[model samples]
Structure formats: C-alpha cells, structure tokens
Target chain A: MPHRTEDIEIGLLLEALYQRYHYDFRHYARASIKRRLLQARSHFNMSSVTALQERVLHDPEMLPRLLGFLTVQVSEMFRDPSYFRALREQVLPHLRTYPSLKVWIAGCSAGEELYSMAILFREEGLLDRTLFYATDINPEALKAAEAGIYPMDRLRKFTENHQKSGGKSSLSDYYTADYGRAVFDKSLRNNVVFSDHSLVTDAVFAEMQLISCRNVMIYFDRGLQDRAVGLFKDSLTRHGFLGVGSKESLRFSRHASAFSEFVPEEKIYRKREP
Target chain B: MSAPPDRAVVIGASAGGVQALLALLPSLPADFPWPVLVVLHVPADRSNVLAGLFEAKCSLEVKEAEDKETVRPGVVYFAPSDYHLLIEENGDLALSSDEAINYSRPSIDVLFESAADAYGERLVGIILTGANNDGAAGLAAVAAAGGVALVQDPAAAYARTMPQAARQACNAALVLSLERIADYLKGLKAE
Candidate 1:
C-alpha cells in the first residue's frame, strides 16, 4: 500500500527527530504516534505535520515540547494495588534471600511507580539493602521523580492504594503535606537514582533482581517490544523477577521462554535458571 | 443502504451496551467478512468478560485485542477494558493506557479516528446504545474520512443519548434499527 500523505510526513519527522534530538519514536506503534503528532501540530499552531517537522528541525526548543506530546505521562502512585500486594507477598520472599538487591523501574514516569516500589521496599525492611534505579526517556519526568513532590490533592487516592498494598504504616509517614504539596521524605531518595534512559536506544546499565517495566511496551511495535524484553532478559540476575501491567503479557514476546509466570494473575514473570 | 465494500466495522457503546451488542452480534452468520471491533465502557478495576459473553451468543470468534496483533477478517475483537484500542496503518492492533479522552479510557473517538486513518473509505463506524456522548465525534471522523457512519435510531435504543449525540454531530449514512443493522451486516457477506 502506498503511504498516506500524513504517514510520509510523520516518517520524515521521526527520522529528523532521531538524527537531531536522538529520541527514537520511529519504531513506536504508528496510530498513537500519529495521534500525538497531530496533537502537537495543533498545539504549536501548525497546519500540517510537514510544517511542524520544519520547525522541529530548526528549533531545538521545540524538542521538549514535542516530547511532552509523544510521551504518555499519566500515572498514579500504586496504580494497581493488587500488583504491589503480590510483590510484597509473593516476590519479596524470594528477594529476602539476597544479601543486597537492585530494582530497576523502567519507564518510571514522574516517579509514581518508583515511589511505590521505594515505599514497598522500605516497609519490607529491604530499603537499606536495595539500590533503586528509576529511569525514563523524558527528562522532565525524571526531574519530577527526583523532586519527589506531588500535589496535595492526589494524596487521598495514593493513601488508599498504599493501604491496599499492605502498607505497614500510614502513607502520611512517608510525606509531609505543606502548602498544597506533599514532599515525600528525602530519606526515600537516599538510595534511589533517577536518570534519563531510553529503552529503545539504551542497553542494560546494570544487572537487576527485580525489574518492573509496566505499561511502557504497549506503545511499542512488536520488534521494539522484543528488543526491550530481550534487554530485560539480559539484565536480570539468575531467577530474577519481572512484572508488567495487568493487561500486559510475556506470552507473545520472543523472550517468553526466558521467564516463567511468578504471579500469573498480576503479569509477573520470573527468570528461569539454566 | 449497503456497507462499503472491504470495510471494517468499529462500534462503541457504554450504558446498556451488552443488550445492544447481543441484539446485533448474534444475528450475523458464521462467515462474516469484515472484522468487528467493539469498545464498551467498563470499569478499570474489573476483569472484562465482554468477549466471553459475546462468544456464547455470536458464531464469530471473539477475543480481546492484543497489542501488535494483526487485524483478522471474520473475527470479533473487543477492546480490553481500560485500554484504548488503535488500528495501525498496517492493520494491526495497538493498545494504549494513555490518559482517558472524554472521560473514557476505551474512548470510541480514539478507536474510530485511528480506524478512519487505516481504513479510510473502507470503514463503517457504528454508534449503539449508550448513556454518554462518547461516540459522536468518532462517528464524525469516520464520515470525514469518507467511511460510512451509522447510529442506532434514538427512539429504538434502550439508552438514546449516545445515538442522539451521533445524530447531532454527523450526518450518518444510516440510522438503523437493531434488527436492520444485523441484516445490513449479513448482507455485506452476500456481496
């Protein structure tokens, strides 16, 4: 089939973005990319994607603005309580045997999932022994994650989810609310590192015992999903754990055989020892 | 009016969707030609049984749309609850948990607009019984892309707001009764 006009324009745009900005969305699922690009076009007051591409090529400042559109930033603390509960009950027991641990929260948007894991580790008495790596392609989100502050209004739902995840103490214990912002204790960040990492272009930086890369691959095309899962396979220690979103699965991934279902209902998989 | 040839059907419903789906889907024969994709409003927290329920009633194979799965003819694919279903240019399915649009995660507009891009004139967008106006703008996108737009007649719908909204937004190619819509779908296979 011949490429649509918009499709051609988008192809060039993504190529230009990669060449100049080095942010690769070329292999992302096409429909969502098109949708987000169209949104970016309208937001920037451009008539067509071609015009937007021209501006993006010439103006470096437009990169972050467009990245804001391309990356999905919506997330919540302990978004799925059951997944965390399963982590605490099912996966934590296995990790307890390890003298020290590293947890990689891939695609850790705005620090919500990272904070959830951090709080969980602290509650389980594993925080001191654990090194947390929270990473994403979005620098803005990384900055936000490093800040560890959220608007006060979101605390109610966060508290409920934390409680549901078998939280050992009040959610309030981790944060102090003042002037409509909840500043999570700096102690939570003592062992955590926030960094800019692209699953598409970047390789495994460290071997990890637990990698929670939830909901990020839904935006990726099959080849890209395979690449990320392959990285996970390479990055995991022997019998390490991997958990994805409720709806995500390793069944279709090319690397499926590398992991077995640990908490099947929660989409959690464990690396199989050779 | 006949469905456009080589077209796919994208249907969206919210309140009273199950009854509407049952009334329409079960009537099609075993070898329905065009693939049917549906997005019914469901809570994020619960497991969706939409495919399972439809499988018992419809002769067509029913399953939830998986990420990057190619669109297959004669299959009925339900948008899994809490995910936006999109059709790629290559006619594969892609799922997104991006923020909800128009207060809906599986927003009819998202699916319809994306399908319009993929199928163009070879698409049929349908709005069924629902209490919300989620499908109106989506049906309009289908129409704008030279695809057919359909809506259940408000008076005949169990919940009319959705169809009424579609009527107000787009000049639908057909305002069909549930039985007529089923008959129309069946007629496509004859061609």
Candidate 2:
C-alpha cells in the first residue's frame, strides 16, 4: 500500500480500537502511534494497518498477542546513578524524620529500578524501615520484577553507576554472578512487593514518603501527566519527595505548585502542602 | 493467509550515530518486513534530527517514538531526544523521563536491554558506535536473554571505544563494518 493509504488505515484502526476495546489511545500523539501500527500491519503479516486492527477487534487472541508488539520496554538496574545519589545525600536526611517509609516505584517494568532502590535502602540502613511497592501494568515484566534475577554480567556497568552515585561499598558485594547471570541478593528485594498497577487507570492507594516514578509520565499526555502527578501529590506525605525522569518535569504541570525542587539537576522534588 | 509476524529491529547507536544511522538505515531495503527501533545518543535537549535525517534513506519508514504508542515490526522506531523509549508487555511504546543512564535517558543500554527482555530470541540488538560504555552491559543482557547481539567493528567504527566495550561484555557474535553490517541486516527477516 502507498504510504498515504497506510496512514489513513492507521487512523481508522485506532478509531475501531477505541470503539471496540474502550481503551482510549485517541488522545495519544499520532506520528508514533501510526508508526507502531504501520509496523504491526506488516508484523502480523497483514496487508495494512486497517486489516491488522480488524483482526485484533475480532480475534481475542490477536489483541493480546499484538499487545506484545505494542509494548516497548527498556530499563536497567540503577539506571541513573545520580538519582540514587540524590536520594542518599539529600532525601535520606529528610526521610529519616519518619518512623517508617513507603516507597513506590511506579511503572517498574521488570523491576530493575525497584531493585536499585532496594540496594540503596539497604546501604543507607533504610531497607528495613522501607516498604517498597513496585508496580507495572505489564504482567510479564512484573513477574520478572518479582523474581529479582538480573543478568549477572550487567553488574560491572551497574557497579560503575554504583560508584558514581557515591556508593559506599564495593559493587560486587551486593550480587553473586552465577550461571552467566548476576543473581542479586534476595535480601535487598525482601521488602519489595511487585504488583500490577496502571497510572492511566488506577488511583492512589497509600501515603508514601518517596515516590520514585521515573520514566513513566512521558507516555501520558498532558492531561494524563497531570492526573498521575495529582495522584502522586495525593499519595505523598508532607515534605515527601518525588523523583521523575530527567526528560520529565513538574515545572509546568498543575501539581508544579505543590512541590519545591530538591535536586533539580537530578529531577528530584519535594511535595509541599497543596 | 495472515502475513507473518513483522520482524522488529531495534538499532542502538551512539557517538557516531549521524553517520552510522545514515549509513545503516539506507542499507535496509524499502518495504522491509519489520519496524526498526533506533536509539542514537545525542546531546540532551537538542532536536534529534534522525527522523528528518533518515526519512528518505532507502526507507521501510522512519519516525520518532511517542508515549503509549503501539510498536509494530515494519516501521522503524527511533528514540526521541532526552527520553528513554521503553516497551510495555502489551507491546506498546512507553516513553520515560525517569532519569539518565550514562548521562542519557534514551540510553542505548536502556533500549537494547528492555527490547531484549520484551522480544527474547526474536529480538536483535545492534550496537553501532559511541564513546561511553552505555550499551555494552545492555547488549550483554540482550545476548544473555537469547537475543542476537551485533557490534560494528571497533576497527572501522568512527568511535571504536563503544564497540570495544560491547565486544568485551559479550563475545560479539557478529562484528562488521558499515557495509557488512548493512548486508547482514538486509539479509535478516528483522533487525
């Protein structure tokens, strides 16, 4: 099919999806969505995006299978060392005021970032006091997150991050590299409760001292971003901190007024009274 | 009959991406069977010219990723500036602002490693070039998770250090120069 027709088919398919599935992707930006659908058109061995959408609407199995292709998950353990450093240097002091801590790692695909937090808590002597809730909508990724088995070899690089993030101990002490993979110490993830939660469809469940929702808001539109931010603000205790991805900020959001910048460079913010 | 599952190719580039992407993307045949996901490290906050840069280069199709977008195999997926583009289990694109890794939100490691987890053996992870040791560990994870790992030849890469880092972490099942890598991908059902 010509490129123009392909794009047209994509729009129609999205409409069909909204009507049939009741999943509102209509508000999502177009170029990327169309690009993904166009790829799907060929991926499912269909002739066009419209045809691919048609199959998904009728075939129960197809939607879930196609759902697999639609998801683009990329993350690592201790991804941004600086954020952890900020948690240690600045946020920890403030967090110590509370008797116990509730830390949420939202959209924690496969749990790398959550485990990183676990390690940080353990090192900071906050692990016992910390109760982590790692949530994601992806079941497969969530299962992996619960398992806490990261590739053993990535430890070397994560080790560098650990060092740069002002790690106090040798990075190797945390995990044992066995079976050509790094099995992180089970003790670190003990307090972690990995579950399925959606920022698009879910609401606040608990009061948290720190909400580490990195890399999640970028998928949401401005409205959805605000909704999620509002939830974060609602969930956080006063003076609680929120850490977002560097590319993401609360600078212009509705909730922007509710927080003061903690380590602005590291994208850490503290929730203020609304 | 239903068409075959589109082969999805995710390309991770750094340091010399402008040249590498231009060279590699053009080599991919027009109407290739899978979408290509490209992550090239650029200075954060700058406009990533990749979409415009590679729009005409021998194209299956080229575009940047967006939040909550579904990903397909035939279209090429490029990481936008300063954001980590991830795959949801639903097989959709989820853009992230969590933080930077190796000083990059759209770090090659972030993309490759996640894609590795998402696609498993069906996935192919390619590390073209870069100065930092960003994608090496991720590529190793990809290979470990049963995805094929491709590294451009350090000798030929504009930035040999990045390729060498990747090569060190994994055996680098395939090491090729621009032309050879291009040929290898062209022969693939998906990249």
Candidate 3:
C-alpha cells in the first residue's frame, strides 16, 4: 500500500523527534499516534500535523507539550481490582519467600499504581523489605507521581477498589484527606524511587522480582511490544513475576518461550528458570 | 446494487444496545463479505460478553477486538470493554485506554471517526438504540468522509436519543427498523 501524504509527514515527524530529542515513537501503533498528533495539531493552533511537526522541530518548548499528547496518562488507583486481588492472593505468597524484593512499576502514571502497590505491600507486611522503582518517560507525570496526591472525588472509587482487593486495613490508613486532595502517606515513599524511563528507547535499569507494567504496551506495535517484552524477560530474575493489563498477552510475543502464564486470566506471567 | 467489495461496516450503540444488536446481528450470514466492527457502551468494571452473547446466535463469528490485529471478513468484532477500538490506516484494529470521550472509554465517536479515516468512501456507519449522543458527531464524520450513514428509526429504537441526535447531526442515508436493517445487510450479501 502507498503511504498517504499525512502518513509520510508523520513518519518524518517521528524521525525528526527521534533524531532531535531521542524519544522514539516511530514504533507506536499508528492509529493512536495519528489521533494524538491530530490532537497536538489542534492544541497548538496548527492547521495540520506537518505544521505541528515543523514547530516542534524548532521550538524546544513544544516537545513537552506534544509529549503530553503522544503518551497516554490515564490511570487510577487499583484500576482493575481483580488483578490486584490476584496479586495479593496468588502472587504475594511466592514473593514473601524472597528475603528481599525489588518491584518495578513501569509507566507508573501520576503515582496511582505505585501508591496502590506500596499500600498493598504495607498491608501484606512486605513494605519494609521491598524496594520500589516507579518509572515513566513523562516528566510532568513523574513530578505528579512524586507528589503523591489525587483529587478527593477519585478517592471513593480508589477506596472501594482497595477494599475489593482485599485490603486488610482501611483506605484511610494510607492517606489524609486535605481540602479537596488526598495526600498519600510519605512513609509509603520511603523505599520508592521515581525516575524517567522509556520502554521504547531505554534499556533495563535493574533486576526485578515483580514487574507490573499495565496498559503501556497496548500503544506499541508488535515489534515494539516484542522489544518491551524482551526487556522484561532480561530484567526479571528466574521465576520472577510479570503482570500486564487485562487485555495484554505474552502468548503472541516473540519472547513468549521464556515465560509461562502464572495467572492466565489476570495476564500475569512468570519467567522460566534458565 | 451490492456495496463495494472494499466496504467496511462500523456500528455504534449504547444503552439497550445488546438487545438492539440481537435484533440486527443475527441476520447476516456466515459468508458475509464485509468486516463488521461494533462499539457498545459498557461499564468499566464489567467484562465484555458481547461476543459470547452473539457467537451462538449469529452466523458470523463474534470476538472481542485485539490490539493491532488484522480484521477479517465474515467476522463481528466488538470493542473490548474499557478500551477505545480504532481502525488503523493499515485496516487493522487497535485499542487504547485513553481518557474517555463523551463519558465513555469504548467510545462510539472514537471508533467511528477512525473508521471514517481508514475506510473513507468504502464505509457503512450505523447508529442504533442509545441514550446518549456519543455517536452523533461521529456519524457526521462518517458522512463527511463520503461513507454511507444509517440510523435506526427513533420510533423503533429501544432508546431514541442517539438516533434522533444523529439524525439532527447528519443526513443519514437510511433510517429503518432493525428487521429492515437486517434485510438491507442480507441484500448486500446476496449481491
């Protein structure tokens, strides 16, 4: 099939972005990328994607604004309660056997999932021995994740999700409600590190006992998904756990041979002993 | 006359959609040549059993759309709950959990707009019973892209607001009852 003019322009834009700023979005699923670029185009008051790309290539400030559109930032605490329940009931027992633990929350948007995991660990009596890494490519999201605050309106759902995930203590134990914001307990951050990382371009940062990277790889193309899965395979210890979003699967990944479904319905996989 | 061989069918519905779909989807035969994509509003926490509900009744195969998967003819692909389904430039399916549009994750507008872009003139967009106006602008988009737009007659719909709103937004090519819509599809297959 011949490339449409707009598509060729998008290719050039992604190429320019990679060569100029080192953010590789070339392998993102094209449909979402096109939608986001169109959004960036309108937000910047540009007539077309080509104009937005030209502006972004020259204006350093445009990169961050466009990054907000290019990357998805939707997340909520314990977004899928069943998956958390599976983690708490099925995965935690095995994790408890480890003398120490390193947990990686890749694409940890706005710290919701990180705090969710931290609170879960605290309730499970594993917080003290666990080190957590919460990483994302969005600096604004990273800053928000570091702040650990969310609107009070969202807490009701979060609290309900926590209870459903088998919370041993009250959701109130993890945060104090301010005027309209819920400020998560700083103690939860004691063993946590927030960093900028990209699954698209960055290499594995550390060995992980459990890696939860949900709703991130759906935006990637097949080859990119394979690359991210390969990175996870390389980053995990033997028998280490990997949990993905409910809709994701390792069954089709090129690196599928290296892992087995640990919780099939929950989309959790465990690395095979090598 | 038969619809073009390259034509793709995109359908969107909300409240009372499952029943509406039951009345419409079972009519298409196993050898239907056009791929059908559906977006129905579902609760975020609920699992999508749309495929399961239709698989036994419909002649065409029904399954939840997967990320970046190629679409096949004679199949009915329902958007996975909590993910926005899109038609990619390469005529494949893509899913996203991006922030909701019109208070919906598997938004009708998102699917219809992308399908319009991908299929262009070779698209058939239909709106059925729904309470909200999520698919209104999207149906307009389909019409703007030179695709055929159809709507359920408001009097016959389980909920009238969606089709009424779409009627207000665009000049739909046909506004017919569920049975008539099924007959129209069967005619396309026969052609």
Q: Model 3 off-target regions past 4 Å?
A: B1-6, B189-191
| Model 3 lDDT tens row, B20-84 | 99988998888998899999998875577779999999999999998867888788999998999
Clashing pairs in 3: none
State residue A47's C-alpha deviation in candidate 1, in Å: 1.1
**Each prediction's TM-score against the native?**
0.96, 0.60, 0.96
Off by over 4 Å in 2: A1-24, B1-191
| Deviation from native of the Cα of residue A228 in model 1, angstroms | 0.5
Q: What TM-score is obtained by chain A of candidate 3?
A: 0.97
Point out the worst 10-residue segment of candidate 3 chain A by lDDT: A1-10
lDDT of 3 at B87: 83
Query: Ten-residue segment with the worst summed lDDT in candidate 2 chain A?
Result: A27-36
Error of 3 at A116 (Å): 0.4
Scored on chain A only, each candidate's TM-score is 0.98, 0.88, 0.97
Among all candidates shown, the one with the greatest lDDT: 1
Please write out the lDDT profile of model 1 over residues B7-68, one tens digit for every residue. Answer: 58999998888999999999888888899999999887547888998998889999999887
lDDT of each: 0.90, 0.76, 0.89
